[model samples]
Target: MTEALATLSRAYRMRVYPTRDQARLLAQLVGASRHVWNWSLAKRTSAYRERGERLNWVSLSREFTEYRRDPERPWLATLPREPFNQVLRDQERAFANFFAKRAAYPRFERRGGRASMRFTFDQRRQQVRDTGGRWATVDLPSLGSLKLRRTEALNGRLRSITLSRDSAGRWHGAITADGISRPAIHVPELDAVGLDAGLRDLLVIADGHGTRRVPAPKALASKQARLRRYQRQQSRQIAAQMRAQGLDPTKPCPKGVRLGSSNRRRKTQQQIGRLHAQVADLRRDALHQASAAVVREAQVIGIEDLAVKAMSRGMGRKAFRRSVADAALGELRRQLTYKAGWRGRTLVAVNRFYPSSKTCGACGAIHAALKLKERRWACPACGTEHDRDENAARNLRTEALRLIAASSPATPRSGESDARGEAAAAVGRTGPAGLSTSANREPTVAGSGAKADRRQRQSRPRKTRTDRVAVGSG
Candidate 1:
């Protein structure tokens, strides 16, 4: 096991920026690979329906090899043997993944765009040498020497290499290697921090160190506007071109222009695609950095598991939902999980039901009613004045610590159980289900109880008048 671990530890990925000629070769490889994949998929789907039996990679490879021997199947001649074999393997893996419920039914790969090819590292044939520059030189079969940017030093035995091109026409090499596994850090005993994720304030982190606000980048909004404008312009150009070609503008634009058409529309479309890519890159970079920082600093992090899908209701009216989606809270969580694993930090998810807002952090008192507009409130229980967001942050940290301490195997020290019990009690009181009954329990006139209740119910805002009447009658 240790020997296997040692072998695995040495592998790492090196992204190579290929030259123009190399980029063209990559495109050919991708196209060939996708063609093979689609052909195999069609064959397999037909066979599965007809024969009621599954085809393995070895059988498919053998079949393709025989098919390629026929001069009549001219397209088969264009397919590279290595990429063809890879496509068969990819298909088999896709089927396996489908059975495991990891993914949906595999789709046919399209040709002529972003072609990817894979090559295994053969120690005897391939040599990896440090160039003393930014990238290291790796010898590839037939393709010869390729320089890849070494983001990190290569560690273990190289297993396989996959070459892919992004939409931006950049080549990337993903190298899988074997090496020793680093020991994961055990959940540490340190101050817990609460993060309030929002659009305006990207993150409101509150801990013993005090509250700090991390605002969203102003550039993101600006870039989005530019992207939208460019996309609209591209659409207009395509429509104009269609009109010039005597084609219906309302219908889908024909692939490739008429024989004598200008290239203006095609160039405009490319410009729009580049702008879209730029915006995505900026957003992704910002998310990675922000998530990394959070994982590095906090021992235990607590964040609201907001149901973004549900929150997106009424999104048509306001563009706020779009901005929130761009914030990518889900992506933040994903990065934080892996980053925490790499750095040995703990990320605790607080329940969506947890009322960090309604509960007073200082006195542990639950407010009978707290609205979104009540940003500043004075806690009746402790006389502590609180800013809603900052208060929520504090409560999150407190709740997270309480949860961790309870879940720990070690017995609580003197007074620890008592403090935990009080925190738990408070949580039960302020939680969503717990507070639902509070509205019904509001004061009523003693003698005129029915009428008072009717008046109170009518005064309370309801989604419909029928609902108000139903509650009033009850």
Candidate 2:
């Protein structure tokens, strides 16, 4: 028998350049889509308010045909019908998310915010035309061909392509396709690593032997001065606009006043947008390099289930908050998740409150008195010295491997060999399905009797490839 390859959905974002005519048409499509989304939202809201009836996409889409044919809004018929219909579908999805309690209510989309349109047609036709060297074109219906910079070869079935304009005034296309790839299978006894995400160091990776620290980049530090200068110019320009209107500069822009945009103000905003894009690019570069390195080195990856949002609210220092934002821990974890799966590696997430820093890996004793300020501490029980970050990584690695060993059906039974027992003990665990306390114990989990303890272990959930145990304490 042969193993079958798995197919997964993937999206590739490519830089797109449109000609003068195409740009105008693309802009019109974006505006039309925005208007459709807003109008549909209003219609749905009014229907539910007046008649107490829910307006689904099917009825709304049907009414849209008549609305487009109406003389009052004939401009809606100028663009391709696909985007207007897609906007309604997108809203329907948003409503579904809201109903499922995954998102808030759908709101009207504003102009000049997120200009994008999707083309979801048949994939049997080659919508993507390769121009040979470093150039290609995306063939969207009615919009014509938009030039594309082909950085990599397009693969699989092209399902849909979304064209979007960024804040930097650049056009791009997000191509979603379905592709087949070989699944990753893990080998037994490979290296397992624990990762600690921190602002000081980008990542602290620990395996059985030692720890390695990857330094976090100071994101766009060099461009900060330029960014600040442009920001000041914008502020001064805004106040000058208010003063020109014979209104108090300190007060807000009045209800009907138009603080018209100047060439300088527009240019300043563009520069600011470019600077932000550069900073994001730099951050992604560092994250990708570090994550790729880790995925290549270790087979079993472990990390703490950090609550980044909660940490920020309680954080006192301004510098700490800024650093947390720049660290991009969430982005790094997302990359690790997909990349690890693609490479057939195992990922284990430790419970956030699992005292990785306070627990002594030497004797499995958690140092309850350990403080946040103490970068290094001596374990009171084992009398061993420990570096805070290093100890945390080591402890994380221990717990991760312990989970792997315990849940694994292949782990040697108690009667197998003395060598297997010693091996399990070396990693601070016992035989397969045995309680993880110093290796030689019979089952000291929380149960009083032997059968009760066995039942507890049996009922305990076994973790999958990316699953993390919710248990925090020893």
Best by TM-score: 2
Q: lDDT tens digits, residues 1-474, model 1?
A: 566643334446567866676666667667767767888888888888899878888888898888777898675575446666777898899988987999998887655444678877766655677888777887765556788889887666676778877777677888877764555758554556887765455667897779988766778667766766765776677677778779897776567856344587677667766765665566557778877787667666766543334443442313433434423554454455445444445555565567888899888898868776677999988889998888888887887666655453223243543343223222212211111111111101011112323443566553111100000110
Model 1 misplaced regions, further than 4 Å? 1-14, 19-21, 72-80, 100-102, 112-114, 123-126, 183-474
Query: Which residue pairs clash within candidate 2?
Result: 184-344
lDDT of each: 0.62, 0.68
On a 0 to 1 TM-score scale, where does candidate 1 land against the true structure? 0.39
Model 1 Cα displacement at 271 (Å)? 75
Q: What is the lDDT of residue 461 in candidate 2?
A: 52
- Model 2: weakest 10-residue lDDT segment is 439-448
For each candidate, what TM-score against the reference?
0.39, 0.44
lDDT tens digits, residues 85-166, model 2? 8899999999889879999989888888879999895757787889989899878878788899977888777888899999
